[model samples]
Target: MKITVQLFARARDLAGAEHVELDVPAPGRVADLKRSLASRFPQVSPLVPSLLVAVGTDYANDQTQLSPDVAVACFPPVSGG
Candidate 1:
């Protein structure tokens, strides 16, 4: 399955793209997507440890299940005053 991921903040800059497509098997987990991202875009891999990943509208953990068509977005964890 192919998943379109929207990049934001630092992740977007590191990847040099606002969006990227990743190949994943159906019924994949958030961890799977992270691995694929690292493999395909090494520049963005460093953020994985602190990256925030969202599936649909909620922030998801490594084990969260995802469908191919779900809305996925990734960005470095945010901090505000």
Candidate 2:
């Protein structure tokens, strides 16, 4: 399944785009999504380890199960002083 992932902050800068399309497994987990994102968009690969993944508006962990029609987004952790 093809999923459109939204990018923000450093991820957006690295990917050079607001969004990216990835080939994801149906009934997938965040872990799978991360791997796909890394393989497909190596520009954002570095952030994959510490990436903040949101399935809809809530932050998702690696084991979070993903449905076919869910909104997904990823970004690097924010730290501003």
Candidate 3:
């Protein structure tokens, strides 16, 4: 399955891309996607642990299943000075 992931802030900078398309196994979970992302973009690996993933409008956990029809957004933790 192919999933489109949206990158923001530091994640976009680390990936050097605003968006990325990943090919994962069928019925892949968010955790699986994370692993794939980390593998493909080593620069983003350190930030992956702090990143938040959203499926559609709702936030998702590692176990959340991914759907090709839906896009996933990856957000880096926000810090306000």
Q: Write down the TM-score of every candidate.
A: 0.92, 0.90, 0.93
Candidate 3 lDDT, tens digit per residue, 1-81?
Answer: 999999999999989999999887889999999998999999999998988999988999999988899879998887879
Q: Find the 10 residues in a row with the least total lDDT in model 3.
A: 71-80
| Weakest lDDT window of 10 consecutive positions for candidate 1 | 23-32
lDDT of predicted model 1: 0.90
How would you encode candidate 2's per-residue C-alpha lDDT over 1-81 as one tens digit per residue?
888899999899988889888888887889999999899889889889899999999999999988768899998998889
Instruction: Supply candidate 1's per-residue lDDT for 24.
Output: 73
Score each candidate by Cα lDDT: 0.90, 0.89, 0.91
Better of 1 and 2 by lDDT: 1
Residue pairs with clashing backbones, model 2: none
RMSD per candidate (Å) reads: 1.0, 1.3, 1.3
Candidate 1 C-alpha lDDT tens digits along 6-34: 99998999999999999877778989999
Which candidate number maximizes lDDT? 3
* Residue 7, model 3: Cα distance from true site in angstroms: 0.3
Candidate numbers, best lDDT first, in rank order: 3, 1, 2
In Å, residue 77's CA in model 1 sits off its true spot by 0.8
Clash count, candidate 1 = 0
Evaluated at residue 3, the lDDT of candidate 3 is 95
